[model samples]
Target: MVDTALFTIRDERLSLILTRRKDPPFEGLLALPGGFVHAQEDADAEAAVRRVIRGKIGFDAPYLEQLYTFSGAARDPRGWSVSVVYYALVPWPLLEKNTSVELCPADELPALPFDHHQIVAKAVERLRGKATYSSLPAFLLPGEFTMNDLHRIYQQTIGARLDKASFRHKILEQDIIEEIPSRFRTGAHRPAQLYRLSSKTLTAFERKI
Candidate 1:
């Protein structure tokens, strides 16, 4: 199974979690955390991904989904091999800085060894597309955040500016989120209500899809 864990972007940079192979055939080259699926394990793709992440990256992913399968003679140097690619989404704060399993910013990602660049491009496209009609981007935010926080994430994921009033209206109308009783006071501006994801709304959206 091929696992693609997308590190959260912070300070206007996208990060990816990669591991240096300790064995031959692409040894020492940074690649997405993954490995071969064991024959004895569960047949579920998500479970296989969790197993791969635990074995290769030493962490259980918070978010994961099947991306696609790659099966081509030229894709792998090991003769004939079929890879099941999975996408992992990680929040920014969950990542450690300057460490082995740490984040590698998009701007500084060195030349990747295999078809990783293509995999990443596809993952990004999926992320953006999902962000438009789903609450996938909410996974990137902290436990408590402002409307501005939600808006910024939407803007970043979709790469566009959203109308503030319409954004707020649609979000509230859909009942996807609820304001927390507590308010955060930042600077001299009026206190803004902190909001959290609504479980009911999430369930509704999932059923719709």
Candidate 2:
């Protein structure tokens, strides 16, 4: 089985982790980070996906979800194969500090081996679509932030501008975040209220998906 991993980087750019293939079928070309599931070592598809990610990228994602599965005889050169795909989100700040792996922009990628490009495109689409009603975009931000910070992340993820007042109203009504009482000091202005995800689990903010 095959597996893929995605992470968001600075400036709200979504990137996919890719490594050069050194084996047969397609050698010396960049492709999604993946490996065959070792039946003996893995208890399930999810476990194998996690193992592939940890071994390749060396970091556990704050949020990880199964994107889709692709299967067919022609998909792989070595007989028939099935691929379980997953997309993960990590704060941009965390991505900048990690240097273990290379991240390629999902939308502006080079020629990829096999059907990896298709997998990246599908993952990107799902992330943007779900950002509208879910808390998925919060994974791109820091733990403590102001309303403006949260709003900007959402707007960037969805690729649309939102009215400041309206967006604030919706966020407050949803009760997805809670105020920290303490304020974040900004230069030459009153302190801004700090906010964070009310629930510790990233996906627990909303269950719309």
Which candidate ranks first by TM-score, i.e. highest? Answer: 2
Candidate 1 residue 189 Cα shift, in angstroms, is: 3.0
lDDT of 2 by residue, 27-106 (tens): 98888778878999999887887888777767777788899999988888877888988887777676665565667776
TM-score of 1: 0.83
Maximum-lDDT candidate:
2
Model 2, C-alpha of 139: deviation from truth (Å): 1.3
- Per candidate, the number of residue pairs that clash is 0, 0
Give model 2's clash tally.
0
Q: What's every prediction's RMSD, in angstroms?
A: 3.3, 2.7
Error of 1 at 119 (Å): 1.1
- Tens digits of per-residue lDDT, candidate 1, 35-145, equal 766668757767777887776556665667778887777767877767788877666665644356656765467667667777777877777777788777776776777
Worst 10 residues of 1 by lDDT: 200-209
All candidates' TM-scores? 0.83, 0.87
Least accurate 10 contiguous residues by lDDT in model 2: 200-209
Structural RMSD, model 1: 3.3
| Candidate 1: C-alpha lDDT | 0.70
